[model samples]
Target: MSYFKEDFKYDLTSSIVVFLVALPLCLGIALASEAPLISGLISGIIGGIIIGFFSKSSLSVSGPAAGLVVIVLDNVEALGGYEPFLVAVSLAGLLQLILGFAKAGIIGLYFPTSVIRGMLAAIGLILILKQIPHLVGFDSDAFGEMEFFQADGNNTFSAIIASLENFNNGSFVIGIICLGLLVLWESKYIKGVKALKQIPGSVLAVAIGLILNQIFISSGSALAIGKEHLVSIPILSGEGGLTAALKFPDFSAFSNYQTYVTTITLAIVASLETLLSIEAVDKLDPHKRHTPKNAELKAQGIGNFVSGLIGGLPITAVIVRSSANLDSGAKTKMSAIMHGIWLLLAVAFFPTFMNQIPLASLAAILIVVGWKLTKPSIYKKLLAVGQQQFIPFVVTILAILFTDLLIGIIIGLVVGIFYILRANYKVPYNYSTGEFKTDDGREAIKIELSEHVSFLNKARLQTTLDGLPNGCHVMIDGSRSKEIEFDAMEVIEEFRINAPERDIVVSVKDLPGGKGRMA
Candidate 1:
């Protein structure tokens, strides 16, 4: 079908873009998890191919999420080994499957819009800050952790200073060249070059880095990508094949309480992150595609399930990869599948070439990604949404920046709920008699208005109307009312227009400050 053909073309483009972006992220997340570097790539491949097959989301890309880094690291250390932790991961996947089937995916709907937006903005800022050191040729062990400070005694700001102090000239030069090429590729000057436009900035950066690395090697210079900054996949000789890389879960650890706790924690965190990313990716879709939340949860569950069985980290719908996919013109889920295929082929056939790509160049690509997510325009738009929305939004941003994602979202939710309650408390009417006579000898609802009514009373009025019986003549005793709020008056006026449909009659008593007849 024409639809299928068009989708395939889009998928190919998206797959290439996401593949380039995902390759580095998989390694970075693995480093953060304190697991074998190969674990991250395996998760990425499984997430893309396996999750893609099951996912109802056409545009979302799945991978190991940065948000789970701290937990993953803690669990790995606590469990004594990555192999034992696989047991917990399998349990986590099962729990996620339960959550999806139970319709718990709807939990994302309860998050205040302001909080979600603020979270996104804060995450963008964090990504930019964290990637800066790498972009400038620093290869510290603390690559993907979200903490402002590193375990190596370097805070975010201090890390920048450190990178500047010990910057590697060779790596820095390569990074600058790559960054310049990326910027040029994105510029309007190249807009007319359709062929060039199809090439992803990330791909261009990698290609240039590879070329520069060859040049350094040929010149016998000390400016090559070191093992510290390259992906380290274990190469098995003597009858191992792909199975040699696979690690299985140790079910013997399931007896421990810590295993259960970690499993539940991973499930909850992974599910929430996936749901949030799915929402974001759908929003970013140029075609305005809608992704099914429940289905996405199931797909992530399946991905994590397979990942655990094969000794890989749990997977989630990752925003960075999904964003890259959208920006690369991904039109369907096939792009995600193609990305997985690329990862498989790269690892299986071109590990040597992939290992040569500089981490600095990939870091540069991520820097651009971080900037796009945290643009100044985001702040301006938040302000324009008004204080009622902006206050929670700002609080969420600050909380996320100062603390972590979970705590930040909690604080924002509490603040948002407080505002909602405060708004609800402003209503002015109180019920008087429980029963009143109707023309047909039935009880008529009686509402006694306070001295004044206001916009905040909208909920109370709506509640009263919702509870009223059909064919009831509601008596609103406003004789004692001092003033009617404009919003309340508007509600009454609108009701007057459609009162017949509801079979209700509204009789307003004496006007508060005037000698007017009851209406």
Candidate 2:
């Protein structure tokens, strides 16, 4: 009971920090998914409250993952509407449940360490690149859609250039101000500000955004955050009840093969992402917490099923929120539940207040999160680990930058495996005496060299054989040997040739053509 009480306090503080971080991410990811903003919130709430309660993880935070954005958008567009997409999401959740029950959660363990690290670094890089334009108040379309090459017309780099070319001075001013305040709050100077220390930097940034917006409104400036930039929840007014905003899935689309294919894709991708996130969060936990992977899968599946039924996008254990929770000192799962409850309450009672929060402010928070994940210090640390580890790490990073996550991982795994084989190939074999003894001394020697033994193992095999006593019988053991290389087999043959002068008999057993000993 005492332990529970202690953890409760920590959970409250940590959940608040996570909530602050998650609010904008929920909206951003929903926008990226081509789903309604409220749908994202609904998922967030269910993920936090419902999944949080059932999950065995103490540090993991669940919500809409950025990795699923492309898939979600494509599915929604293909399915024609959000209702049809919900049906797919529900089916995907059911598939994940089956996977968990089958103990397929262990599949995440097979991914190479180098590849996993590369995937994370790549995600961090993407987050930074994608969020930069938003931080600068240049949201041309939805969030996370800014690619290297333009999907429609402008690429990520081009979008940045265009934003700079037609920069909104008012929005830019507010963003810069909020960014500056956040920087100041994070600085050492704020250490002495005891009361202010409790306030999250995101909260302070939001305050600045609101103040700037009010000032702009008073001055008749055209640079305020427009309706497109703010979070839009479909709040039920007096005439329309809450049921008006709520939507159910249209299962009629389930008969379509495309719908089934989309659902399977979603299920596989979502499960992989969730399992990976669960592993990463466990690794990041300060207490060295071990999350039950199967339990987590079940919880996520349940959450997604419920969320889809209530018109929400699919949910998963999101790294961004989980990292924030850990960094903010969350001690147990209760914090996640609290955050979910807060999300529901805030939307239900304070939609008007949430609408006042500026997009730039959330963008600033994400910018900080991105920088934390891809800090120069992390790179320096990776380099300090030495080339053996660094080679694969660096390769993974580059592969991820050039290709997608799954492809990048495969490349890194191949490189790591090659390195391992190369390292192992350096060992030399010693069969000069033709007397190999097992550690238990129960197994006899059966020395048979390949047709082509290289010079690489010459010295090693030579040293081993030369150190043997005179009583041990030397055997050429070339029964199955054919076309032996001059460099390696010649060395052994030369030793056999000269052994007669050293009171040693070299006997060849079963030569290639059934010939006896070679004089």
User: Per-residue lDDT of 1-519 in model 2, one digit per residue for the tens?
Assistant: 986767776777778767877887787778777677778889999999999999999989998876678788898888888898899898888888888888888887766565566566666676667666666667775664423444466665677777777655656777788778877877888867988877767667877888888777778878766765654555656546566766789888887777898889988888888887787777768789788788788888888888889998888888778877876678888889999988998778887887776777766766676666667877787778776567887787777666555556678878887665554344433253326543433323334555445665576556655654543445556555555445665566666666666555445665443245743
Name the runs in model 2 displaced over 4 angstroms: 1-5, 77-80, 144-150, 219-224, 238-241, 401-407, 420-519
Model 2 RMSD, rounded to 1 decimal? 8.3
Quick one: RMSD of model 1? Answer: 8.7
lDDT of 1 by residue, 19-106 (tens): 8778878877888777877788889999889999999898888988877888888998888788889988888888888888988898
Error of 1 at 17 (Å): 2.2
> What shift in Å separates residue 253 of candidate 1 from its native position after superposition?
2.0
Best by lDDT: 1
